[model samples]
Structure formats: structure tokens, C-alpha cells
Target chain A: MTQRKYTKEKKVGEGTYAVVYLGKTEKSRQIAIKEIKTGLFKDGLDMSAIREVKYLQELRHENVIELIDVFSNDGNLNLVLEFLPADLEVLIKDQSIIFKPGDIKSWLLMTLRGIHHCHRNFIIHRDLKPNNLLISPDGYLKIADFGLARSLGNANEDLSSNVVTRWYRSPELLFGAKHYDTAVDIWSIGIIFAELMLRTPYLPGQDDINQLDVTFRALGTPTEANWPNVTALPLYNAINVYAPPSRQELRNRFSAATEKALDLLIAMTVLDPSKRCNSTQALMDDFFTESPPPTRPENLPSKNTNKKQKTE
Target chain B: MEKTSSLSISRPYYSPKELSYLHSKTIADSKKVIYNQRKHQVYQYLFQIIKVLKLPLKVLNTSMIYYQKFYLFNIFEEEFEDFSNIEKSMELDPFNVSLASLFLACKNEDCIKKLRDILLVANKIKDNQIEENFIELQRKIILGLEFKLLQILQFNFNNQISFSTDSLVLQFCKKINLNYKYSLFCWLVNFDLMLTPIGLTLPPHCIALAIIIISLNFKPNDLKTRELSSGVNENILDSLNPKDFKCPEKLVNEGILYILDFYIHQYNLSILNNYLPQINEDLNKEQIFKFMNLKSKFNNLRTLNEHSIDGNLLKQDESLSLFDYSISSKGTSRFINKRKRLLEEID
Candidate 1:
């Protein structure tokens, strides 16, 4: 009964598994159509596509990228998704733009809300990074790229540890803990928070082992005292001992952040996954309730010129 | 609690009376050997695919659902309009559609399988009349029609309250304090219903309830009969609290009558015993090609002749009545309309 007609304008983005095309419906609704490259995946409709279609169909929230429709044509599976203007990574990397700290709060709040909704529905957004967070024309952050999402694991079920990007992966995941929950996503949010404060990645490591090394270097090495049962993990025996950083050293790194904000960030980025602040706890922290409320999205500066330029 | 209620509402499972329309539709014309008599042959094909592929029971169940849902979009009337020469309608061949549904179900269930492997197994089980290349072509048609089939089915997968019947069985046993011996009987009724249109028609819980009620010999009336009336376990009933497991007497009776009718009328059909031979004798490559042509025409796929002048456009009817009424009538109009709109969009 529902009729839709769209014209393919041009290709927008291309990846190994899919190609995105810019399209406009009869109503002139701009849409992004992603066609899953067929005959490449030995399995028809790769698991990632299946996960995206399955979870997106169930989850309908404001901060989540909407999957408009799905259809197969010419033996290729195509997903019709909301066309987002830009991604958070683009904003973070744009040195020409000076972002207010309030803007960072707004983005992180929206991200947490989106991930919270997914967690409530028993889904884990296994992959979360700045690149996967898109900004709409309204400047609202929307979570995109649900390819690695999955339902929460049942009791005694072992999920793959090779999920979330290595740079943003949690300590428990790095230690090869197969049974993990939503704390993995909270850790990524912590890294994003740190990146926003510093205007660069906090711990950008080359590989899984190096990623652990960098994590320990930044946050003290985990021992039985700090993280109970720390060595029982499958890959924990391989972890090299690194001396703990002093409180002053940690304070000096993120000096730009308020003390409360820093405390929340530390809670999120804790070495112990069980002790990490979850989405709800993180949102309810004093840092968010204290002075300098998240910026009103519209009034937030899209791009700011530095005072040096004005003086010149 | 609100989520549970909404989940139930979304699936929209029907009663036997509501699904009886599908039964009549499957019966097709009352004139010749009723298609109802031959309908059971499709289940045999599904069973063959399950056995050959060693698919899980869930995959087989989903495949039957797909097969039943497929016919709702594709009726026998449109398929047999050009069946003047052929004795049996190849357009609705259960074997091919069952194989296709099974293949699609594999993907749906995350049990990935190669198209070639499935085709080989299907060919070996049935008569090898289909050439290997033709089988490949069949695979293409199946995959091509996947989206349309999904749209027609209204994406009903993942909508059910999974294992609701299993819980019901456990609850019933705990209530009566009787170790459940009715599981096998329940499975028998459920699987048999898959072959029939009953699965598409009735809620799984209602079916399970009907089986339990009959096997337990519980009184249909007396709403107050929630307490154990059976003398076998009065002490057990007294020791345990029984959850109210109630169904409308009408639904239980209808379920019983439906299964009874199937047993009396269709139980002795030849296809039930030897469907492989029937599939072999009924299906051939030429018939398949002819059926494909008919289907493509129905879908309004523009074809090229020796002169390549768009064969489909030429089939446009002379009368407005035929053009609008004939094509637009029946439940299949949803598929036709969507396919037309999608084709335009793609172009």
C-alpha cells in the first residue's frame, strides 16, 4: 500500500562490502542507499548486514541512524538509510573549527543516550567510534554503522573478543574476556571524552598488544589489588608489567577538564570492567549536573576563528 | 507487561475460521483433481530438503512458513491461466518453491549454505530432469524473488514470542503435577500443521493448548474447573498451584476439527507416500521455463523476443476492465504494485 519512488543521483561512499549512493525520493527526500556488494561474501548478506537489518528494525530512536527500507535488486542487497551530512570524526579532525567544551558535553550526552537505548533493548553496539557517529543538519549526533551490533549474550555464552576497534577497546576485552557486557561501550565513550578534551586520540595504539601497553601506560598497570581476579583472564598472562603513573602525572595530562569531569572520566576508563560507570551512572554523575550545562545544540559554534587570526 | 501484549498484537495470529479462507484457496478449483489433494506434496519436498541438507527443525519450520506465505502472494488462478497443454501447473511446483524457501531459510537462520550445494542435494533427491545450468538459473529466480517474497510476508520473522508453547507445556505439567508425556504428541500435531495451512492460520499457543486439553481429557466447559478435576493427581494438584490455562472452547474445537478433517480426507493421499516420483514426473526444464515466462509476464518483466520489442508491454490488455480488475484483484496486488513502483524507482 505504501509507494516510494527515488532517483539515484550519484555515488557517495564506497567500501569493500557496500557502496552508498545519494538518492532523492519523489517527494525530494534525500536518502542514502547502501548496496551490499554481492558475490563477494561467500555467505549471502554478510553477518554484519544481517545484524544491522535485524537490530535497526527493532530500534527506532532519535539519535540512531534510521534504516528507511531494505530491498534487493540485480542480485545485490540494498539498505535505504537516512542521509547524514557529516560525521563526528570530521568535526573532531577539523583544526579550522574551535569546539567549546559544552559542545563536547552535548555530543557525549547524545552518544550515551543512543547507546543506552540500544542496551535497554538487549543489543550491544559492539563498534563505536567517532567515525561511526554522524552529525545531522540540526547538529544532533546520530549513531551510525550498526554492522557489528549484536544481542546481549545469554548466560554462559562466549562472545568474540575481537569486536570494538583496538584503539577504543576495553581492558577486559584486551585481556580476552569472552563474557562482557555494556562496559565495553562506556570505555569507548571515555576515550572519545579524552580525545575531545585533548583534541587528539588519547591512546592510539598500533595493535591489540600495543593497545594494552598504551592503556597501561596512561592508566596504571592492573594488579590483583586494583582489579580483582585480574590474572585469570585468558590473555592476562601475556600482559607485561608497567609501573603506575602518579596522581600528579594523570592530573597534568587532562588539566583542561574540571575535577568532577575528570573523576567521571576516570570512572569510565577504569582498568576494572566491573567497576566502570555504566551509561546510566555516567549520565547521572555530578559533572553533568554541575555548572556549564551542555550547550544548546543550535547556538553551539559550528566553526570558530581563533583570536590570533583577528589580531593579524 | 506492555511489551508482551504489544508483541502478541504485532504477530496477528489467526484462528482456524480465519485461516479457512487459505484452505479454500489452496483447494483451488473444485473441477479437476483438487489442488488440495496435491498440496501435501509440497511438505514432502520440504522434508526432503531438510533431510538432505540436515537443516535444523527451526529452519524447516521457517521454510514451511515461507512456503505458505509465498502462495498467498502467488495464487493458482493466475499461475494456471496458460496451463492449456500441461496437465499439472509447474508455476506452483512445490519442489522448486520448497527448495527455494529452504535455501532462503538457511540464510535467515544464519546457517549459510552454498547455492550450488543446495541445488545438487535437491537434484539428487528429486528426479534429475533439471539440468545443472537450469538449476543455477532456478537459484537466480529464487534469489531475485526474495525481496518481493519478504515484502509480501510483511517481514513477520522475529515477531513471535519464541518458545511460548514450550513454557506452556512446562506450566501445564507443573500445574497437574504430572511429568509431561505430551511433548511428542504436541510436536506431532505442530509439525503436521506445518504441512497444512493451519500454521499460517492459528497461534502456536492455541494449537499447543488444544493438544494439551485433548490429551489431558480436561472438561471444555466450567470456567471454575481450573482446579484439577482428574483423579490421577488430586494430591499433586493440592500441593501445587495451577496457573489458569484457558482457551475459548470454540478455538479448541476448531483446532481438533481441523486436524481430524486433515486425517480423514488427506491422510491416504499418494503424494504422502511417494512424493519424489510425483515431483519427477510432474516437473521438467521446459515446464520450468514456461512457468518462468508466465511469472515474468505476471510481474510485468519486460522480455525480448527474436525481434526484441518488449514482449511484456505488448501483453497490456485491450479492455480497461481486464487491465485494472484482472491484475489488481486478489491479495497479490500488493506485490505487483510494489514491484512496479520499485522498478520505476530503480530506473
Candidate 2:
């Protein structure tokens, strides 16, 4: 009989499908054990848990959250993952943490590297958001929560258009495009990049309907002239035709951003997915190589600093 | 301190001899014939279900692999011996096991269908009356067996090395510029290999390359599959390299021999039999004789060397031990795919 390898110390979080527990391995390595709740849904096992195990097992990278081990105890499926105490969302929401130009570059660089690994493997991290980007103790960004991730299938296969959070959703996704590619993830990363600078969500819409209006209002309405097949999308509608933002307008909006930084952001958030820069292209952009190089991982701002200050 | 019972290790690929050694403990000699017969019936049944669902070929291929892999660790059912009276015994039905395998395979392949919907199609195919309580009961059984299926699979979803074998066959054929007839021939062989243990032994890319090599050698010009107008490009075969498809030479050799042996013995029970002519026009003999010819020619080809590993040593291998489904209930059963991680844990 196999004995328990991990001891659950305390419950950290709970979602609809799984309850996450702060745990420790026998070797005293801290880990987060996500105990998936089964027998609750009409389906046998949760699809998210299946997706998590499927992709995470194959992917091994420094910027990707490590799926340490998968074990089952008392019929509950537990995924032992590398313990990440903080996330990009926490840092973004924390007003005390001052954002530096180099700090933002580091986070974005790490995020692109992680996403590049996923895209190269043909697996799209469909739900790439600030919250999904976990920060390790050393401040390395590891892409986590593969519940919504899926490998790119055949050309004719129809993917669900209703994915990615409403705020970070791309223009193509907003128009109900079912055959979008890795560009969708790049769009999310671009929004996250904007959010890192602004210290808040770049495009915070009230609801799904408002998301399109908000997205177009900021990035300008996509038309056939800019995006050739924009009008052909399933939900394509030009209720309000806002003109594309000029370089001066974008500069005014992102006052602290460099010209190269804005260039990469613009390329990533292109309305037409085909025209959008991929992870590889974005990683190779001049913004990443310009002056004030990305801060080292350990030097990045973390939530742990605030905690330590409060205790002192 | 009492050592906590936690088994963390990666299972190595089993050779044919090791596979038979493990099977000997799970299956009795008398029941071997019955097991093969039932497996064939289940394969046909699953194929029907897959067709009705309009699932891709990869889903069917994966489901069959999972079903065969499930029986490797679990006992071959004796209660559900009679296919005609399958509904009589609901507790240990092989059909339920097949359904569970399909369910997991669908999830793994990303062509997910609801378990309830899958059950509706399965029950309808079996001509079993769809009662609400019966559906609910069977659903629970399939759900329960799903966890066991995961345990049997050891939480490893990447069964194929790269893409699914069927897709890789098409991709490799296109890479070598083989025409539609040759590609279809490789695909038909892949369809046949799915029902065998070749998938368990070799990666999909190697199997794909092996099938392509066989198709080049056989040059099935009279294949009955659609779009058979194009002729086989024999010149491309001479320039073929296993490294191009990320397949090792020895593994491809293993796949080539395994596929040939499978067709030589089980040609009558294969999808290839339905498509290809019974008598090979080139060889002036039966189809089995063509496979036999290929087998004799490749008799001295270098393949996976299993000579170093002893059969007695295989018995002592902990990963080969029969999976204890109840182990998770009593203790933790850790599944790690990487051997390096297991070594680190040991350190």
C-alpha cells in the first residue's frame, strides 16, 4: 500500500471545481495541492482538471508552473503544483508597489517567454490573464491554470468563441471568431502589458456586450479596410465606428511608455489576428532590447515585501 | 516513523516479453482465446459508437489504445463472456469498461463529449432500453471506472510521442510527397495497428514512419479507399530518413516488424482486409502471404534490443505490478511521468 506523500497544511482557496490546499512534500518542499472535486458535475471528472493534467504534463519550462506530482487520496484527485504565493494580479492591485519601466519589461518578457513555450508546442493557453500568471518566490512568472487551455486542432474544427475573460478578450474573439489562433493569447498579454503600466485593467467593460464597445472605443473599431475579413466574422457589427487611435493619442494614453514599448503593444493588439505579432515576434521586438533592460527576476517587486513590512 | 505508503515512479515501455509476463498473472491460459475474441467485439462496438458520434479517427484510435491498456493491468472479464447476454451482467460488463475508456480518450484527445450523451448513443447501439434509473446507474459505474482508467494510464495523457498516429501518417505522407493512395494505405494500417498493442510499445511518429515504409514496399496500387488515382512515388522512399520525423531507426524497425507480424496473423480481422484486395497482384499470392514475405525479408533488421532485460527481473519491477485501485483510498498514489523527478524524489 502506498502512503500519503503530502500533508495538507491549510485550505488556501476554493473554486467551483477544486479546492486548493497549502501543503508540504515529505522533503519539506512547499507545494499547492489542488484537490479536484469529483462526482459533483453530470460528467465524471472535471474537464478543467483533465486539461490541466494533459498540457502541464508535457510542458517543462522555467517560466511555466511545474506540475510536481499528481496523486489521488480517498478518491479525490490532487495536483501537486509548485507553490506560487503571489500573482501578477496581486502586484497590479497593490498601490504600494511602485511600477518601474524595467520591472514592467521583466514581467512582460517572462510572460512572453512562458507563452512562447506554450505556442511553440501548439497548445494555446486560452485563459492568459494577470491572475493566471503566477509569481514564484524568486519573482519568475510561471503561466498557470490550464483549465481553459487546448491544443490547436485541425483547420476545419470549430472552437468555442466564448473563451478568455471579457476584459482581455481580443477584437476577433469579441466578433465571435471561432477559428482564431495564438494571436488571441498575444492580445491578452498586450492588455496585461497595458494593465501593468496603468496599475489597473486596461479595458474593464461592464459586461460581454459592453466589452466590444469598450475594446473598440480604445483600440478603434475594426473594419474591412484594416482587418480584411472583419465584416465576415459571426458577430461582426459596427454599431459605433470609432477611428483608429493615432500615435499621438496612444502616446497621450500611455504617458510613461517608450516609442518601442507602444510599438510592440500596438502590434500585439492588432484587430486582425493574422496581423498581430506572435509570441516569438513580440519577444524579438526592439522594446525588449531597448535601453533600461528588463530587471532580473529577483529584483522585481513582490507582495512578500509588503507582508514583511506589515509584520515588522 | 512508519514509512508512509507512497509509490512514485515512472513506468518504462514494456517489451512484448515483459507484456506477456505481466499478462500471465492477470489472465489464465484457458481464458486467452476468450479475451481476444471479446476484445475484437468491443472494438467493433466502440467503432460503431465513434461513427455515430461523428468523432475524428484519432478519438477512436485513442479509445482503443486505452481499452487495450486497461486490460493490461486489470483482469480480462470472465463474467461478460457472452456478447449476446451483455446486458445480463451490468456489474462487470466489458462494454462499460469500453465506455469508460472512450470517455477518458475523448477528454484526452480534446474532442470531449458529455458522458450522458455518450451513454445515450452506447445504450441505443446495444439495444438496451433507456430507463432514467438505468442510465443514472451506468453513468455512476462509468464515472467510477474513469478514475481507475486514469490510474491504469498512470495520469499520462501524452500517449503518442507527438501527434496522433492517424494524423502523423497523413503528415508524413505529405512530407515525403506520397500521393493520396499511399497515404490512405498508411492510414488503413494505422487504423489496424490501433486495435493492437503496437501503440503501447512504440510512439506514434515511429509507427507512422513504419507504416509509410511498409506502404512503399507493398505499393498497394489497388487500395479500395477513396481517391486512389495517384500512383506511389517509389523514388521518395529511397531518400526517406527516420530522423526527419523525429523517429529513431531502431524504434521504427520495431514498429515495422510489429505491424508486419500483426497483419500476417490478424489480416482477416483487420480494417486493411476490407480495403485491400484479398490477393496481392504483385506478389501473385494472398494478402497474408505478402505480409509473410515482408516479415521474412525484414527478419534480420535491427530492432529494440530486449535481450539485456531478463523476464524474471520484469516480475520484480514495481511499475509492472497490477494497479491497486483501492490504494488511493487507503494512501496516496503519486504518478510522475518524468524519470528524473522520481530520481530527485529518491535523493
**Candidate with maximal TM-score:** 2
Give DockQ for candidates 1 onward, in order.
Answer: 0.12, 0.62
Reference-based lDDT, residue B136, model 1: 59
Give Cα-based local distance difference scores for all models: 0.62, 0.84
All candidates: TM-score? 0.65, 0.94
Error of 1 at B29 (Å): 6.8
- List, residue by residue over A1-312, the lDDT tens digit for candidate 2: 244467888887788888888878888988888888876365877888888988999899999999887887777888888888888888899898898999999999999999999999999988888888888888899999889899988776778888898898988888888898899999999999999988989999999889988988999998889889789898886458899899999999999999999999999999889999999899999998899999999999888853110000
Runs with alpha carbons beyond 4 Å of true place in candidate 2: A1-5, A40-42, A305-312, B1-4, B80-91, B225-228
For model 2, residues B178-277, the per-residue Cα lDDT tens digits are: 8878787888888887778788788888888999999998888878866646665558878898888878899999999998988888899888899888
- What fraction of the true interface does each of the listed models get right, in terms of native contacts kept? 0.02, 0.80
Query: What local lDDT score does residue A103 receive in model 2, on the 0 to 100 scale?
Result: 98
Candidate 1: where is the Cα deviation over 4 Å? A25-29, A35-47, A69-78, A153-161, A171-180, A216-237, A242-249, A270-275, A303-312, B1-18, B26-60, B75-96, B109-142, B145-148, B154-157, B160-347
Q: Chain A vs. true chain A, TM-score per candidate? A: 0.93, 0.96
